[model samples]
Target: MTSQHAILTAEAHRDLTIRTERAAALGDAAMCCITVPDEFRAVQSEYPILFRLSDTRDRFTALAMFGFENGENLFLEDGRWDARYRPLAIEIQPFLIGGSPTDDGIGQVHIDLSSPRIDQGGQGERLFDTMGRPTPYLDRVAGLLGTLDQGYRAAPDFFAALQRHDLLEPFTLDVTLDDGSRNQLVGFHIIAEDRLATLDAGMLAELNAAGHLLPIYMAIASLEQFGELVGRRNRRIAHGRG
Candidate 1:
């Protein structure tokens, strides 16, 4: 089979399913729960981009999340994160669920396109052209998020093994913004400890060569705007309770 076919076959083996109800709840709630290794706590704590919520007594569950608004502005506010980083106006929403061995003992992370309010008129058309028709990249990203959930569920032990060995793999997901811009979200960059250090140097070099990283950075920067809005809602709720 061709390389693309092989990849699709492998992905098919996972049997992923997107839980729309759960995803919608998360968007309405505007939150996510991420579990990381205990050893990464200090790194996470120091990372201004991520916010830590709580940790399990065993220290295995380092619960934290990234505010959509914070994610939106991450790049623009600080171009240093990625030198090629630029600022864009897009929207991203994430949701997560966790459980133990019976349920695979692994937590699932899901991301959705809550909104993509771009001012440009041709944004969608541009993205469609870049990705090609039928199963566009935006839909594929959403599908992958669900697939990620299945992967986590199917092999929690394997995930832990990767974590123990410090051998996480990097992957990319593409999203089409409201403005017709296409955004790529790079994954498995372990926050402050490595940032982009662990990424494939060749890929980074290629991106640099192609000069497309800045726009991606800007797209991610757009997430911070969403994060801020969630923060505001949270604060209002807290104040009301107080």
Candidate 2:
């Protein structure tokens, strides 16, 4: 594990508390929105992991859907929609399922982190194994992951840019879940600052110069919606159990 991962793990073990409520009363029309601390957001934004669809532009949508991080199953009026595509039949394991601890010894927001059965070569390999050839969508997602991998590989320079501006800071985040009950989570929350906003202008300028920004954002939006669909399905599975 990297230092960043270690830090998050230690934070996860802390006894912080978060506020939560049961989702039962929400009656399938509400989405759980937890207010994460700026620190956590910063860390999340900076972490090398491409957990967010926006970060990778949705290239890993299929992988993310199978793994369980962000999806629509978490919020849907009806829970009978079958995912359009199912990721490779790899074992599904629940990662971080629960609330995060707050800085003030409180637990907040529910978190669930899971890993998909991505093969040794990552999505590309899984795609080949599952379909014999990569479809356009699969190829797109693969390309997106590739781009993100490149960006993460170049994080040293990215960090340098932030350091040059003297804007580097330790991060902390608090999560809250509203399930008609209250829960608390606390620990060492870490995230990189909104260095993205600062970098976006430059990044966008470069992308615009290269004529590849608008298309990228559009792709990202599509993937984000797809991930939401998966989340909604998962949520239905959860509620159906009750």
Candidate 3:
């Protein structure tokens, strides 16, 4: 939950510093939610990008599958992420674009002051320079937050497209590690290839024109990464790292 949020202006946070270190503490099960339109290509190569219904089950959001279960992130070890590309959703941690306004504006950067990444002891990237201007790191974070905000706003339309086309379906994943332990991944949904194949030309054209086609295919391609996830899990178990 957000404990406090203020507009991230240089004046009020000139001395603030953000930890650039990898999130070793997030542990084995840090599943970060992602928006497909922006993060699909960035996430597809290294993570099994999947989808999950929102609490209301009214729409689905893409998820960068980090661990098999809560507190079990297979990609984290020795303070490093095992994959080459960490999803931006994971990269932008403890900081997010504000969803509501506080007399400033609706879309401004807000930092979770309680986040473990916040450090005033000067161990991380400084948010602003002596001139009270945003530092390069802060500038980069602002870009990330801006991209996230755009994706956040675009999410409803994307999901609405999926719902209109009836492309999503629930599927179960069962994996066996080297040690003979079985893991069944549940509650996740995927694009129904059959349904996608059966779409009429007019409907496909509509999805394509609305910029939903590529992301839909990207989600389909991401299913291949699930095999590689099993390999990572097997190695972790073999090396006593799981």
Candidate 4:
């Protein structure tokens, strides 16, 4: 809903604060797609990492599953994240690194002007220092944005290889919480185990040469965490917090 995005400058954004609570800022999204390729390993241990096509249908995005349903992040409670690892996509919100519409090569930070979490008071880390220079917080944000931007460019090549190998498939997650409530998560995709197995050695070698196999396995391994998520949801409901 942000109508405008301005390039970040020290003078104009001296009063800005980047809120760390992303679940609220992102409307409590159930899935956070990974941007950087390196995120697969870290994300796999905690969340069920999945793959999905981009809105444009031109490429794919890796996602970290947080909850079974929309606006229901089971890992979030009392304004804190239960998991030690939060996806970089979740860590960076309300800010996007984009090119100028008029000149595609002119790249800069684009902030969501409509975000309620993007505030003017010193509620979180200050964007600028007293001397009108970017603070360490801003520097960190720059690094984070840079990583995601690079990831965006790299995802196509990585996912294209998986697509060529026909290793991706649709998935549905159905579970029952302890309170006798059932949850079904849909509209996500997972790596196909049988299809991956069917790949000939030459295709396997190609995937290995492209360095796409490990993340595939990592995503598959992360599916086990779905059980943990159900348990967390059940515990929350049990404690009357749901």
Candidate 5:
């Protein structure tokens, strides 16, 4: 579907409602989504945090992996996302931050008219109240968008720091399901534990003083979730759903 971006306003969207359920039709059945360092702690516990280079190959973005293959979200089941937390990027679907927030310290909200989450039948949360004022749900979405914007803006520096310290290394996951099917995931990166451990005191101090240390460790800790992720896939296969 073609995306129709429109500046969101209470006046225009007063009657529109958003379907909050997690479903593949609502664009939730994905293997991964863009994530930020600020959410590493929460995301680490649910998804495998990994890094990917942009299309231009000049920048890196953090990703919270939900499955090993495209269009396969292991955590999605029975109209719900089977996870305690969802990445902000995924949660803010159908809404995008428009305009330059950094210039004026404010952002314009744009909604995708083509998104399946848009409900005209008034079946979900209303975007605006009867008086055309922003509803509490809308307010929360705005705040989340603001956080997403800030985190997106701050991500490049964190990636650059990792590169500077040579802390990122290419990684691949080879998965063997219970049914004897094998899957290989590539084109991702992970924190180099060996390199990180061997970093000199000065380098460690630099990373710490710059506030990049915790997130770095968070990404490393997130690797443990990969085991659970594989287990989820195996379960799906066992249930004849894979």
Candidate 6:
């Protein structure tokens, strides 16, 4: 569906109430989300970090994997996301940082009118109070958006560093379920531990000085979550829900 994005404003959305819940109906069943280096530490703890080329194939994006296939979010169960930390990209739903028309130094917040999170029945948290000031919920959302924007701006440098070091390599995952079913995941990239190991002390120091080493390690550590994720998918298959 085409998105209907409109600049958010208290005057236009004073009564808008956003439903803060995790459910498939609210568009929370994605298998992966675009991630940024700023949130890698938080995201790596809960999800496997992977990489893929952008649609234009001119840039790379980090991804937090939640499941093996499209529309299959294993973290989402029983109306909740069973994780300690969610990627900022997923948390900032229905709202996004949009470009300012006047080339001002400020970012504009835009809302997707087609989102199911829009609760016009007044059953959710209001975006603005009666006085037209942002409520605590909206304030929190704004903060999330701000962080996301910063993360996006910092991503290119991180990807470029990975490329310069030749640390990214294509990988394929083959999974076998208890039911004897096989699944293959292809066309994704991950930090090549072998290549990373080959980096000299000087290269390592350069990455560390640039604040890229920690996140690179975090992404590598996140591979351990793949076992847990596959277990979730296995359990779902056993329950007849996979």
Number of backbone-clashing residue pairs for each candidate, in the order shown: 23, 54, 5, 2, 0, 0
Give the per-residue lDDT of model 5 (tens digit) for 158-177.
Answer: 99999998898999999888
| Residue lDDT tens for model 1, 1-242 | 11111212213222222222222222222223343232122323322122221234221222233323322322221212221211110121222233443564534433222332211323232122322332354355445444445533433442343344343333333544434544443422322224435657775565455543342243234334443434443444455520
- What TM-score against the true fold does each predicted structure earn? 0.24, 0.27, 0.91, 0.88, 0.96, 0.96
lDDT by residue for model 2 (1-242), tens: 11111211323423321211112222212221211111122222212112222254321211122222322233323332133322111111111112222223322222222222212342222323233444353354444433333333333343333335433333222222223322222221111335434555776586456433332333224333533444344455567631
Ranking by lDDT: 5, 6, 3, 4, 1, 2
Model 2: ten consecutive residues of lowest lDDT: 87-96
Weakest lDDT window of 10 consecutive positions for candidate 3: 24-33
Q: Which digits, one per residue and each the tens of the lDDT, describe model 6 over residues 134-215?
A: 9898899999999988888777889999999988999899999888988777899999999999999999999999999999
Candidate 6 wrong stretches, greater than 4 Å: 100-104
TM-score of 4: 0.88
lDDT of 4: 0.76
Off by over 4 Å in 5: 100-104
lDDT of 3 at 234: 89
Clashes of 5: 0
lDDT of 4 by residue, 1-242 (tens): 63567777776877788777645554555545454556788888898887777678777777787877767788777677888887776666667787732443736887776766677865777788778888887788788887767666666777888788888898888887788889997767889999999988998888778777887788889999988988888888989976
For candidate 3, write residues 23-136 as lDDT tens digits: 555322465556556678778877777788888977788888876776667777677777898776777776788764223455778877767677774778898899888888
Native-referenced Cα lDDT, model 2: 0.29
Model-by-model lDDT, in order? 0.32, 0.29, 0.78, 0.76, 0.90, 0.90
Candidate achieving higher TM-score, 1 or 3: 3
Q: Rank by TM-score, highest first.
A: 5, 6, 3, 4, 2, 1
> What ranges in model 4 sit over 4 Å off?
1-3, 21-36, 54-59, 100-106
